[model samples]
Target: MAVGSFFGSFDWSAFLNALILGVSIASIWLIAALGLTIIYGTAGVINMAHGEFIMLGAYSSYMLQNYVGLPFFLCVPAAFVIVALVGLILERGLIRYLYKRPLDTLLATFGVSLVLMQGVRLIFGSDPKYLAVPPIFTSNFQLGFVNISAFRVIVLGITIALVVALWALFYRTRFGVQVRAVMQDKEMAASFGINSDRVYMLTFAIGAGLAGIAGSLFGVLNIVLPTMGTGYVVQAFLVVVVGGGTLAGSVIAGGATGELQSVFAYFTNDTFARFMLYVLIVVFLRIRPQGLFAPSAKRR
Candidate 1:
């Protein structure tokens, strides 16, 4: 197990290749985790329907590309908007009613997710949809023996851009100030004449919207199934929890989570790696009881 003996002649080239793959996975996790971090940080609501929102995005993108015959570039933002709208509608309807009863909020959002996913199933059947990368994007280069796909590179680049844009919006805007206000102390924010209800609604919508965009991008980069969002939702929460309860915490958690999952998947069975990852999360939560970097003031 000594460092020098662990690899008599380690290959730096292979190490770089693995690093590239790790970056790809990490970028995706950042998007998925953004949804949870925003909603949980701003509104203190654990929206279970978050995944279904992603499902909505993926399907929206599918419809735009295939059914509407729109171009691929157009489908990207349209998918984001469509998902954001779904989140908005859900907030105005079901989410508002269950806010006071948090435990019920979970059930309500879970119901929304079930309903949304099942609705897709009924309308589209259980078939998976596909998105074709544009010709210029489809062509990729080989680095020595490794073949890197164009779509994977696109996913990583877009995810990085999204993270930067979100970070700016959250930390730089008045909207962000109001959101942080409510997050820090809802009752106090309301007392100071801030519109708590409206903020909550918008915050939730953004969270759902983020998930939707992530799902759509995921579909483009991978497979599009009705249950596709389910895998991501679980991953998102794990990232959020592992990182901590704050927005920044989620990012930190997501990167770590994605890296571990990637490394494990390479050397171990995917199923076992996934299980142990969750087990590790549970153990960490038990030890800290407030995520790795959760705000002490928000601790219940």
Candidate 2:
């Protein structure tokens, strides 16, 4: 009788809501991981400063909106451009030099991350900043048994659009061929007249730009702080690792992790859910270290 009563009172609506929310969570993580996947997959650079790039994007949007009164939509693209330029400069000045030494690149990017965090704290005074979006996105709407945030729906839509755009960019463009060529065999690509340096620079810049867009959306989802990027970066890394350095892998890993976390949290608390997720990831990695989608033989 007790078990039957418990089952009878189960909230199917809440389950539906959690499922929808899982999609939103997956969208956020996928957006964050996409850039990392591209940079790592193509260049074999594990970017330790990716979180800082995300922070810079949020701050970029805040600065534009506060100082220049740019609309939210405009600020999104502006942040992308700003961060992409930063990425380009970094790739040219520092990252380009450290490519052959993976350890040096890792340490250098870690230093860059510290510098960016401190710089933001100095400039912004360690205060939390808020991004204002349009009123239409501020409200929630009910769809059947689940209530969903309009902003989350917008974010999901944007993520889907970006994914499609990235796919097209990677598959249907001449630049894509150049990037893939460089990824497959840099020496061979250079011999064939493909400038590997130029390709790496552009790829890093695009990766950073995608991080910027994620940051822009994230700013709308939560308060922006110098340390905000740290939280998201961990999840992004997990996605990239579990997906195994591929674009399609990132999408699948993000969705799977998000849904698992959501479902776990629905039954347990958030802290426990996270703990469980980490444990599961650890066990999975122990068995299949190559991840869900392995990179090509050349990438290995």
Best by lDDT: 2
lDDT of 1 by residue, 197-279 (tens): 98888878777777877877888777888888888888887787777767677767777776777676655567886888788
Best-fitting candidate, scored by TM-score: 2
After aligning candidate 1 to the native by TM-score, how far in Å is the CA of 254 from where it should be? 1.2
Error of 1 at 24 (Å): 1.1
Question: lDDT tens digits, residues 132-237, model 2?
Answer: 9999999999888688899999889988998898888888999988998888889999999999999999999999998999988899999999999888888999
Judged by whole-model lDDT over C-alpha atoms, candidate 1 comes out at 0.79
lDDT of 1 at 102: 73
Task: Give the clash count for each candidate.
Answer: 0, 0
List lDDT for all candidates, in order.
0.79, 0.91
Question: TM-score of each candidate?
Answer: 0.91, 0.96
Global Cα lDDT for candidate 2:
0.91
